[model samples]
Target: MTVALWCILIAILLPYVCTWVAKISGGFRLKDNHDPRDFLDSLEGFGRRAHAAQLNSFEVIPAFAAAVIVAHLAGNAELVTINVLAVLFITSRLLYIICYLADWATLRSLVWFVGIGLIVSFFVVSV
Candidate 1:
């Protein structure tokens, strides 16, 4: 599969990674599984931020996935360019998560904008 396609998979899985981080930091247990949303909602500090990041990750997936797929279908952008942008988007997400966990609000927002810019770039390049 193309690297961009692989990135779609990574993007899909990223939220689960963030959720795991939140769960681990929040001391999730088997009982918590019965009310996972409540358990996650009750987290604070890094745990809470991680949960927020997880939700944000999920929120961005449709855009990222659609961007990648549309870019491929449009067939205007070079494969390498699409691949690089996809990698950069994933990198931005990882950094965003780290910034969220570390409470770097400004940096996280900047990284978020970068991710959004990358998504837009995919469409632009496809034109």
Candidate 2:
């Protein structure tokens, strides 16, 4: 598969990674499985930030996946360009999660903008 396609898979999995981090940090118990949302909601500090990051990660998947798929189907942009943008988006997301957990609000927002910009670039390049 193309690197961009691989990125879609990575993007789909990213939220779960964040969720895992939140659960681990929040001391999730087996009993908490019955009310995972509540457990996650009860988290604070870095745990809360991790949960927020998970939600945000999930929120962006559709757009990112669609952008990658559309870019591939449209077949206008070079494979290298698409792959690079996809990699950059994933990198931005990783940085975003770190920033979120570290409480770097400004840096996190900047990284978020970069991710969104990369998504837009996929569409732009497809044209």
Candidate 3:
């Protein structure tokens, strides 16, 4: 129950976290007046980064929900583990978004894998 709630909280908050990352990454500008090329480049890179984060959430959130629910149903996966994993997933996602925007390809992918792996492992163990 607590794990499900925390997952839900993190899921809702993750996108905003990504947006904040983009802002910090210099993707956000105050003025509309700027070079088209710069804007295009920023948009492309930021778009991809944001999309990657979104895709990660899409991949993991449902699995997190399913795993927690299944664990509850099956009488396994203690609340502590589930909540801790959920926090870990959220942290990994934050790291992934920052790494993506920073163009740290290897680190980004690794963070993504960790997040997805956490969810997938939960799925396997829950079932």
Per-residue lDDT of 1-127 in model 2, one digit per residue for the tens? Answer: 9998999999999999999999999999999999999999999999999999999999999999999999999989999999999999999999999999999999999999999999999999999
Q: Candidate 3 lDDT, tens digit per residue, 1-127?
A: 4755677667767766655554555556666235523543455566657655655665666666776667567666776776677777778877877787787999988887897787776666665
Clashes of each: 0, 0, 0
Weakest ten-residue segment in model 3 by summed lDDT: 32-41
Question: What does each candidate score in C-alpha RMSD?
Answer: 0.6, 0.6, 4.7
Angstrom error at residue 18, model 2: 0.7
Predicted candidate 1 versus true structure: per-residue lDDT over 85-125, tens digit per residue: 99999999999999999999999999999999999999999
Off by over 4 Å in 2: none
Model 1 clash tally?
0
Instruction: Show the lowest summed lDDT stretch of 10 residues, model 1.
Output: 10-19
RMSD of 3: 4.7
RMSD of 2: 0.6
How accurate locally is residue 97 in candidate 3, as Cα lDDT from 0 to 100?
A: 72
Candidate 3: global Cα-lDDT? 0.67
